[model samples]
Target: MKKSIQLNQDNLEQIGNHIPVPNYNRTSETADIVHIGVGGFHRSHLAYYVHLLKNSGEASSLCGIGLREGDQNLHDIFKKQDHLYTLMVKHPDGKIEPEIIGSIIDFKMGTTDPEAVISQMAHKNTRIVSLTITEGGYNFNPTTGEFNFDNPDIQHELRHPNDPKTVYGFLTAALKRRRDAGLPAFTIMSCDNIEHNGDMARKMLLAFAETQNPDLAKWIAKEVTFPNSMVDRITPVTTPADIDILAQNSGVQDAWPVTCEPFIQWVVEDKFSNGRPAFEKVGVQFVPDVGPYEKMKLRLLNAGHSVMGILGAIHGHPTINACVEDELFAKYLGAFLDEEATPILGPIIGIDLEDYKDSLLERFANPNIKDSVSRICSESSAKLPKFLIPTIQENLATGGCIKFATLVLAAWCYYSDKQADQNGEPLEIIDAMQDELHKAATATSSDPLAFIRQESLFGELAENERFATTYTDMIQELYKTSEVKKLMRSLL
Candidate 1:
């Protein structure tokens, strides 16, 4: 006979002794919140907070709806354990805390049965609809911060609003249902990492809604609440090692286990339309304005990640910790953040830039967290504007040093080559610019100046003499060094 799966109160208690499990209880009452992307981050951050609130005998009405497509595997896994899972927090000091979070009560695969999703959204009890759907899911124009209505998914949803085909469509349909039923419009909280996420979400949702019902759009504009939020946590991709740890320590088989760094920060605008759960009790910072905090995080934390990611990948470093441990790479990252990125970030309220930079270095150098360069390297096209370009633009306008910007662009160009070094190990190039990059790689010109002229990557920055000169010179220097370590050292 197969070995019996072992998960009981005893085993749970043993695990809880080592880590704190969320002592949240679920009443027979229905859910008040629906989270769109039920990924690792959601489990580690938002769900854990909600679970804490529920455990403290507050927000008993709050529960979660995990949205997925055709893949019911997650749904099946959660159902097997009564929608409960252990979240392991890996601290920089080598301490591990595992917690069983139990806020999520239901899972729905909207792609398989759209009607089920629509019905769930139409529920009168649903007051908050939050999302962790990554930047790409929004179908937004990075520069304009507007919904790309021409997106096939958005187009399909627009054409068939009632029988909705996308997330936005489902949301619009659900709100219309609520409006018709005389229920309050649910607050839409975007927990994504995008800058001004709440406003961006509102704009996109409203733009899409306007294309269908102008009056409905106006009503939503007046009634619905979209609260801006700033979220920070370093969540690495789950590995086999994590699975083994969970199985051995927690005595549970979790196919989708989540692991994260100990540090987590969430800042939200103090606004809710249909009321909200008591998240404040669980360390969520409620601020009148999240802009300063958002700017601090976007420029410091995110920008720092991009710098480390590109340079680390080129250096053949596997993880962020490894990259930061290397003397040469660490110096380059520090200079990029402090000298280049920090100077451009205008004054942020209640934050010391130097202290934040030091904390960032410590986080990036945390040996326990294995955040891979490849994970951070994905969607460079989408990430660059938000994380890197702003600093570059600011520095250029203010006549500040452009060395870091130059090196960053060069590192990105090198990463796009899709060629391995002396060991023949391949570098993963993840970006929308892949095809054109490949074409450029085969070109006869060895001049770095010629490469930057490619409009697709640099746009008008290529024509700007100051930027072109600095970027081109750095690329040539990097090519001469031929090794990431040496290239980084030369910059230092």
Candidate 2:
């Protein structure tokens, strides 16, 4: 077999695969958007759109900002490939389409040069600063919804003005530089799954700036625009097996590849301080308010993930596809939506709720995209409050069926017990509050209210007799049966 050529501008002509390459001249294009947290999802979903815009004769492109400690790997890979990477889109019918994404014209790791990262954001031409820094990256209190001023990095940034570590620090410093240089403030767009993500970003950044400089804080609050967006795509962490497959399919050895489901959606609130991209020219939705779409995705899809990921882990299911393949699992998810989740969601424009729910089941059952249950199971401390608890709360308010939501909360608590799965393999409990969660979960086997008693997560909500009873009964049921599938089926 011929040795596969490396994915780069110089090697584009050497490739023989049918995968489309960028049409624009890479050397001439400028970075108009600087994206933070350059992970798999952003590359697959957001940068894919930028690739479309750039390839369709648009001048703007994206430059990723990697500030985390271990970002050197990303820097090295992008440098090796000239910022060119392949995205494998897995369709439901088992067809995998590979496309080379070149819109990410530049990428800089802040670990080596923090100042350069700041400068990139402060650059005059960069109009948009977007993020996909996951749920926990925001560092906000789940209960209070306030920026964690007491976080060590935030404290360090506060003490030392010249040097900084956190994203909040970087944004504050960059915006300050831009303001001083008489450049217009860039729009801050958050693509995270958190509800009201743009609003959260604005609040946190403003809070950070207020501590550093009250004037700068006021300027950011008045001048900058933060647009809320709803982004959906199932892009899992790239594995070695995926890389070898990309090599075979594309005949190009990509150092770091991204694989995602073919279904992609982005709904952005059409608000920007500076001029924005003509993203609407492509398939991006430029809506007046992203609230409805955001709510729908978070409640139905995200909460459903929580339900499946945790329950699936307990039942020894590895990947999401494997979990959804079970008839009991599928039926339980259907009941979850029909009984609990759907009732809480308001009417979304142009969306038939029933059809949307059906599509979600189909997407989850996509065998080609092997999104893992364990991946979704990570960071439950941050995720459950934002994703699942809202539905619980609303269900309580409306006097709706809390059975399925209660079961999900119970599943999470039981899964957190450091207990072994059905196969006798120990399930890894990963969370910021790992030890505490473990202790609480162990206690819940004896005292059902132990986990919910944590005031930060459950608070006064647990004090409600109806929810408390339902939760306790479900936990009790878990203790009786190692077969979670049977339990869920019984509930259905």
User: Can you give the TM-score per candidate against the true fold?
Assistant: 0.92, 0.97
C-alpha-based local distance difference test score of model 2: 0.87
Candidate that would win on TM-score: 2
Tens digits of per-residue lDDT, candidate 2, 359-399, equal: 99999999988788888988888898998887888888899
lDDT of 1 at 102: 70
Winner by lDDT: 2
Against the hidden true structure, what lDDT does model 1 obtain?
A: 0.77
The segments of candidate 2 whose C-alpha lies over 4 angstroms from its true place after superposition are 16-18
Residue 321 displacement (Å), model 2: 1.3
